[model samples]
Target: MSRIEWERIGRERRRVSRWSGGTTAEIAIHPATSQYAARNFAWRVSTATVEAERTDFTPLDGFSRILMVLENELTLHHEGHGTYRLRPYEQNAFEGGWRTSSEGRATDFNLIYDSRLRARMSVLEVPGEAALVAAVGSLPCEEGEHWIHRIWYTAEGSVEAADAGGNALCRLDAGDALLFAVHRSHGEESWSLRNAASGRAVVIESVVFS
Candidate 1:
């Protein structure tokens, strides 16, 4: 059987935490654990706002992390890799075990997954209607034996995901998301997203466990 799921997380449903550096607001997580323990989660997505003061990130011994700046700019200093200055929508990937620290204030999105799972994240910016359609049409649809999941998150503006036949799957506004899953299945399936309003829209695409 083929299946797809859509989940809209309002700002209120998100969990906010105050850290020494600043604050972290969770967007969504896999396995749906009740607590925020790293070992209980296979994957996690959240937004962290760093304060001006330098702060060290918690070490996740066996995980990989993708970080993207959504508001303002920040620099991440990795113990061995040097410093990474990220502007709005810029993304960087690093091993969670790396001793990392951040300076400057900025709101950033994060995607963390256990090292056992393969995952990749990219930021997409659609400037106009035509560009939005093209971006949606370019989503990858691969056939494979292993299960593959794709998560589309609207960082700014609004968009809608649909099938090849123009059937609406879901609408995503700023901070909203759509998650699509595919396992061993027959036949081909294609999914795409289009801008819902006139203006630029930013989306974060995450391909997991592929």
Candidate 2:
């Protein structure tokens, strides 16, 4: 997959629960397309929910998923295997249909990717000024790289970002996000998000490419 161009992924203004488990999820690219909706997949921007009492997931037929704990702490127990604990920003990948289990309640992010489109998926956290811009810009520079970049800034202050078009993508206050896409062959973009408040801002971007 190509690098994730500058985009933000964090919290959104929506939430849902699909499977038997009350495992509600917020979406960035909410699988509106036939191929995506039928596959029950999405690029999880940010999520927080109760842990499964038992293994509870709908299981995909032709897809897989990647998960990363954004905040809080939790343990994951894969059926017969031992339990694994994940810290903030830790990542893991598993078959979408694999019967796996969880151990505790915590918040996390997930990248739901189609197996037919790519073999694996990745999730990353970007911090600071220059690095964030470089990481996000890389996605659009590579060939065949296409991505829907979602950014959210939950810091106590305000943050701003721009696209190659020089249009203001987002001017975020606390508990807000700026969502946009970076297509193949897009030109260079610039952004300046500053914390108006005392707290620092957090950025998350999910890239789906091959």
The Cα local distance difference test for each model comes to 0.76, 0.53
The digit string of per-residue lDDT tens for model 2 on 1-210 reads: 222343444445545665454355555554434333454554444354645554465666566676767656767765554567887767677777776666566766666766654423333233444323433444433444454354443423455665444455556664455555556555544544444445455645445553
Worst 10 residues of 1 by lDDT: 131-140
- State residue 85's C-alpha deviation in candidate 2, in Å: 1.4
Clashing pairs in 1: none
For model 1, residues 1-210, the per-residue Cα lDDT tens digits are: 124444566656778999778889888788676456747787888888888567899998888999999899888999998899999988889999999998878889898888877788887775655534422223344554265566778899988777656677677888787766655343455556677889878889887764
Q: After aligning candidate 2 to the native by TM-score, how far in Å is the CA of 176 from where it should be?
A: 3.7
RMSD of each: 3.3, 5.2
Candidate 2 runs further than 4 Å off: 1-12, 18-21, 30-37, 40-46, 52-54, 79-83, 119-132, 135-137, 140-158, 164-167, 173-175
